[model samples]
Target: MDRLHARYPFLDAARAAVDEADVDLAALVRSGGPAVDRGVGRVESAIETGDVGEPRRVRAELLSYPVARVVVSLVDDPRLTDAYARAEARTAHERFVDDVEGSTPVSLPEGIDLGRLLAEFELAAAVDVGVSVGVDEDRCTVDVGPYLRLASGLEGEEWRLVARDLDGGRVPVEREELYVLLREAVRERVLAGLPLSVPEPVAETLEPEVERVARSLSDYELPRSVTAELTPAAFPPCVEALIERARSGEELPDRSAFSLVAFLAGAGADPETTAAVTGLDPEAVAYRHERLAGENGADYPSPSCAVMQAYGDCVPVEKRDERCERVDHPLNYYATAVEEVSRSEP
Candidate 1:
């Protein structure tokens, strides 16, 4: 007990809190030696004055003693937020032990309070879960938390909540599906000794969607003109492609195919730059576009073109296109591209 205070002072208050508990909870010791009683008395006196220093010091001392930790952990029940108050008082001890056991040992200076650590974890959980968490005198709301979003296969949120709950000693067996996925993902990435950091449950939930979009872009090249505006996070496919190419010592499909197709569809590019970027003579790129247009015989209508058609503004540019009209031409081209791509698939 003395060793713990020297190492971690917050546990003093924790032990004090447990000792002062008037309730007949099994986690506390009803009576003990003068040493224990003195420790509790000192801590309780401090709590009455809002200082908690005496108890804080005692709690810190109790850290070296595992029996104290077990008792402290049991004070908070998972089902009720009211239990958070009890848990809060014990959290510093928990963190101190966890930190000591983890690869990173926490060495807190004197005067560091346990309440701060308790609030920090709760706030972090609230933010990471994208839920609104607030606690008042006796009411706490977790409505915006993971469980609220399960209607959309937002199992990721639920998974994260379960992990938090489990850590807090509140296990919800019904969330086994989420727990399994989280456990699998964690073990797969962590146990393999991978360099990647563990992703939050929110991020894991969106992993499939991100990967799906990325795979769609595996063969689909990005346009040079828009490359500056697009970032890896925004275009997960491009990022994945780049990463895979680097790992395999292979090149991804060039931007030329995409650029050429767009140009053929009437999205012209500057002559010099297109030639340089594609490694094709400027004339060749232009000729290919012309050839495609000639074969398709409709200049591969753009969305703007479709918009113009919809608005009956299908007048030829040579005849004078309007400057003020909105065109769905881009949408038409997009639809056509989708159709062409689908049909091209063998």
Candidate 2:
């Protein structure tokens, strides 16, 4: 596989490289090895940590992208789709940003350049390159249509057109904002034509990978209400799992740790309580608790079900309940579940 293809498996050139190699998915999955492992890892890591982990082997990395697409297709969940696309876009953004700024050493001299990336998204005509303008080194204009389309999902009052620095048919933006818009474009491009058709033979070959990812979609069960009562029995399954892991004092993955601490902090659990459950250094846990309070000025919300599931912080499918279906957010589930526990105790 070409090095560029391994770096960006979504590219047409990458696809062509795969085709030229005659590496069939069915055969590859059946045989199984580094490529398949990396492929499964890509989807799982994206959902869990929000990026396909660092590139390891060239062939494995390139092949893994296709494997990941196939698995995501077989799994066929919109949450996974959203998570996977976001992760891919986020990952691409990091690489592209480093390359554009000339900070990170280039692994491939001809990887996706800014000009081609903009042109690929058909935004080349719409975006005014800042340096090319020969005046301001930090500002550029994006056509209204592309700007609106790309920045639709962006939050904050600053993203609004009325608040924007508009010049004729274009909206002025800084270099950083330009990258943010490009990230959205990358997400949309990656999300085009997804949940591809997986033939029975190929599907059968990829059953294990499908089973693993599909199960991740179910972040376990438990109803909501009264998240601050300090009742372990009232916690949702996903939270319970995190607590279990945290109590071991072994550091959980970043997402899992955030879910645990955030959920506990929201539940009116004190720093001491968090330390006790997590069994980590009391000072460290207390410091995190203080930071959380300072950062949000209140309890940070426990990650939502879709987010939890995507992050793999949620438990297996078999643990999910009807309440999991009824409730959209972890806080909501805890509210009801904690109420039930409180009432039953009295």
Candidate 3:
């Protein structure tokens, strides 16, 4: 149970809700009517005994909002964390939008409200909405508005548009729809707990609002202190390169990102310091550190050059020498570098 709580942070809240009877699990599922009534009874029994298996089955049968409400009552269950998180994030986003619109002076870019644009980006990132933008010569095409349909597993007409200069005469109907779709995509991903990347043009336009939303969320916190001796110069070339790329706001591959986090934790960097060093979200750094320390156990070594290369992060120059090949891990390189520097100095 402790391990489960560590693995799923939301479980604590769910479990508490169930124990306190904060929500009526039976009535919540009853909205699904007679066909799901039996499943609801089983879910209530499971919740009372902390038997996740039965409730999970009920969850599968009652896939609609009614079941989600019941599942949400059991805060300790991971079966519906995604649904719960999405709902909470959406509500937060709505409040954020209202705050932004009510206080700030709104501007319009290409007939779209700036506040709305920022909201869209926030939602997109939180929800993992998928939108692709492609460039062909002067025109940029964006695929839009498939997130809901995709989530429902329904086939829908493809929505797309070619980007054009809005100031250059009448905008095509598809282009207008494209703008709306673009916002929707951005909003979805913002809420989806996924890394977000936007075109430079779009980023520049949304800079202020983006910063505001991110600051408001404060998703990551700074480290109080760095435990290890700060030695950037002694770091392996691969690690140094990753740090630089992260600072420059490049979205690292998932493998590389996790490897960096694990290495930082193993090297005795606290979560906040790790976040600063890697330019990752603070909360994310903390979570990764916790996972590495708890589940993976301490002493996880930094990945070798070969593994780095597999993640598209290997610096070719670092591998030019046979010495680099002999090094078992990035930490070894750092150790060797520090030793050589110490020997040469005194």
Per-residue error at 219 for model 1, in Å? 78
Residue by residue across 266-345, what tens digits does model 3's lDDT show? 45677888898888989877765655522222222345556777777777774445545656556556556666777889
**lDDT, candidate 2, residue 17?**
85
Winner by TM-score? 2
Every candidate's lDDT: 0.32, 0.76, 0.43
> Residue 96 error for model 1, in Å?
11
In candidate 1, what are the lDDT values of residues 14-101, reduced to their tens digit? 4454456442322223333333343333223222321213333444345322222222122211111111222223333344435533
TM-score of 1: 0.18
- Overlapping backbone residue pairs in candidate 3 total 27
TM-score of each: 0.18, 0.65, 0.32
Q: Kindly indicate the candidate among 1 and 2 with the higher lDDT.
A: 2
Worst 10 residues of 2 by lDDT: 219-228
Model 1 off-target regions past 4 Å?
A: 1-35, 55-60, 63-125, 128-346
Mark the 10 consecutive residues where model 3 has the least summed lDDT. Answer: 216-225
TM-score of 3: 0.32
